[model samples]
Target: MKKLTSIIAIATSMATAEVANAQSQYYKKAEQNPYTLVYDGAITKNEKGKVNIHPVKYKLNGIEIAANVYTPANYDASKNYPAVAVAHPNGGIKEQTAGLYAQRLAEAGYITIAADAAYQGASGGEPRHTDKPQFRTEDIRGMADYITQYPGVDAKRLGVLGICGGGGYTLKAAQGDKRFKAVATLSMFNSGEVRRNGFQNSQLNTVQDRLKQASDARAQEAAGGEVKFSGVANITDEEIAKTSTDLYREGYEYYYRTHAHPNSTFLYTTSSLLDLMTWDAAEHMDLIEQPLLMMAGSKSDTKYMTDEAFPKAIHAKNKELFLIDGATHIQTYWKPEYVVQAVNKLVSFYKTNL
Candidate 1:
């Protein structure tokens, strides 16, 4: 009787542990499906174009992030092709700048996948726009996994390109992950440094201001609602400083209006500011073994990030930094001339490296 009682207790304990594990897994899946934004309609590929666009879904950090695959015109399922994964800027969608870059790269004879980061755009995640650096970095790695397994994609020749904040994440991914043979960034924002210190370290000089802002944000969050975020919306004459070294106003105009999508907005959580404070994408630049390319608009305020990050890359014997004189940060997003220049550079870089 004593032996039977002991056996029954052990069995019950084991069953309880299994039940707990199952619940944990279920909650994780729930976290991944916290939210989603569906596109009103599909974006069709141009018949005359050499690229075909297809919607795809993949899990990143357990979240089901959505992406679009652009296959070269002559894509043969039996023949593997080098793949490029494009990451979009902060608060931007896959359909914005990243999509354009991916499509162009695909047209240039590469398989490209442009993805919406977790918690933003059409991707799935809780709290809507939480910007976690580690998670964002994981998103890129997840894309590499998705593409390598994809039909017609040559895993060994995988490449990554990131625009704006996406660029920062790409750098982080390349530094940590060996899957990406080549990595590149356009107008990369050192999110962690920028968050801790304002653009150009202007705001970081004093800790009091940052503390106060964080305190207020926490209070707002505790009040049972989402925290609000602020950023450049529509550009105005008054917003442009007379002695400003960068063409920030013009850049905002290009991104916020000319090429803006209804689903894309600059709103993020005030809590995200805290995350950015510690998020440094170029922390281990010297460790990345892959080829690196950093491109920036000489006239943009965000040029400092690219400038600082490029010189620190140690393992990359092959690295290039191209500065476009007349372009501003936003102009590089979708301006006809600047976009053409960027796409050309990207295609050239990937072709040479891959």
Candidate 2:
């Protein structure tokens, strides 16, 4: 185990150092953000007069969940402010895109929080990498629970933004969680649908076989046998280079190479499929009565999910679907122009509705 840790450390350090050299001008200062791995426009602890980041932890269902809260510049606790909860994507933590969006929203004058899901990242849970749908949805609710009571937060003006798979769970969470006055999603990925039928419905024939695999894994646990796990355990640089899909290609670059963090992983327990395979993000979509804003890249292959889910929100009090022209799925996370457009739309949507 020690040898393995050293090897991973060497590899990740080498990767990040290369990135740092390519980005040498951005890191002229000695200090770094204590809470996040370096990425494009990542915040430093001092924030240099931008929003301030507060690293925090709170208990959710007996597990300690790690999160970062971003407050507006020159924040005044005496005055109430609108707040937003940003949910990270699958295989993501608070320090990645979630934190990026949280910080940007804070700069727009909204208090925002991005939290590591329990059992993932820096959060506490046994049998790490348990990616159950229910737990993920609860994680969003848990963020709302924590941020509403934060100093200077106006609970009545609360909003939420969920990215990728987190966007799917956010839809279900907002269906019944009334505290969030407005709900938004970016590049929403429906995990359950993909897990059951495979990406692009390419695995439609193997649905039952996968279900049996999950069932057997669950049975192993019941018998006190070895814990079975599944999912992408590792990726080769060559594989990433060879991949043709923009989503997977750029996703590997973002999560494993460029913006990699020790807490993120592509693995999850096989038993988690029991819930994930049966769930759908658009289920009970009519339950959401709050204002809604769903955005995605017009050129994203994953745009189909957002398109399918958006029209289902027929009963939403108010709703809009904005596509970032010419952007792909992963580009929205860090590309300067897309990120700027997303933040602009988000600021406007929240301001008008919240």
Candidate 3:
């Protein structure tokens, strides 16, 4: 009888704990805010003589794109300022790390703009969360198009910084777009290689199986059937804890917990894999004549991607690969020490090359 009672008690405790976890948010929503900047130290209001956030919208290939352009303190319309186009990670929105870096660069006197990919985040598109390389690469080019004409921007002095999967697309974009005089990547991720072969090639055996799933998803859309989505919509704390790789485990915590945002998510249209699987970010590396800088966490599990793409830029007359000491893949996103190192290095690189 005592054993039965204890079992029930334990079960009740577990249930209560799960309930609490479900109701709790790691990052609470700030009340009465015009902009949705969720990262630490985000600007609550636009104040003069300080870093100001301007929420702007523009049409990208006929689809409206939501973006935040950060202008440096005391920005004047007539004065010339160097500009940077920042690309967010695969599942990230402009309100997360991309905003953090944009704000940081703005603080350093550079005008930076970070936008959501057309089919994702607060942007508008049918069958939302479509993650395609071509669309993403165009997003980077779109930033260049918009920022170059932005007040006080010097088109010739434009630069770009892409994080995670954005890094991969930036490489492809720079291959053809000569507007970005300097190109840099943070914790670069080769989306095509990973999507086709799987993370670290762990899903290599299931590549054909995944491709079939994507094909089926596309067919469903064509037939006006249910739109199938892939990737995690929601993750339990327990599931996140059990995740094996540092990239995925910390990524879940970052996107779902610590730096959570409403518009950010892990899921993408399964059909996106159809284009993602066959594309490679490192292709046509020689076409990028601009100076390149690739930075990655030395201890990151995904550092292999950066390593693979860095050497392929053979034609970059000036190219440097920087390693942040003792930082993991996700650590570079928010950890203060790591972020400072990356920002400082980036400032120097852009100053020299841009």
The residue-by-residue lDDT of candidate 2 on 1-354, one tens digit each, is: 112111111123133444445334333321255665445677766545668888899999999999999999889899999999999999888888898899889999999999999999999997899999899999999999999999999999999999999999999999989998999999999999888877777678777777888898899989998887665555666656777778777887777666777677777888998999999998889888899999999999899999989989989987899999999999998888999999999999999998
Q: All candidates' TM-scores?
A: 0.81, 0.90, 0.93
List ranges where model 1 is wrong by over 4 Å: 1-49, 215-226, 232-248
RMSD of 1: 15.1
lDDT, residue 166, candidate 3: 93
Off by over 4 Å in 2: 1-32, 47-49
Candidate 1, residue 22: how far the Cα is off, in Å: 49
Write candidate 3's Cα lDDT for 277-322 as tens digits. Answer: 9999988898988999999999999999999888888888589999
Tell me the alpha-carbon RMSD of every candidate: 15.1, 5.7, 6.6
Q: Please count the clashing residue pairs in each candidate, in the order shown.
A: 1, 0, 0
Model 2 / residue 223 / CA error / Å:
2.1
State how far residue 264 of model 3 sits from its true place (Å). Answer: 0.4
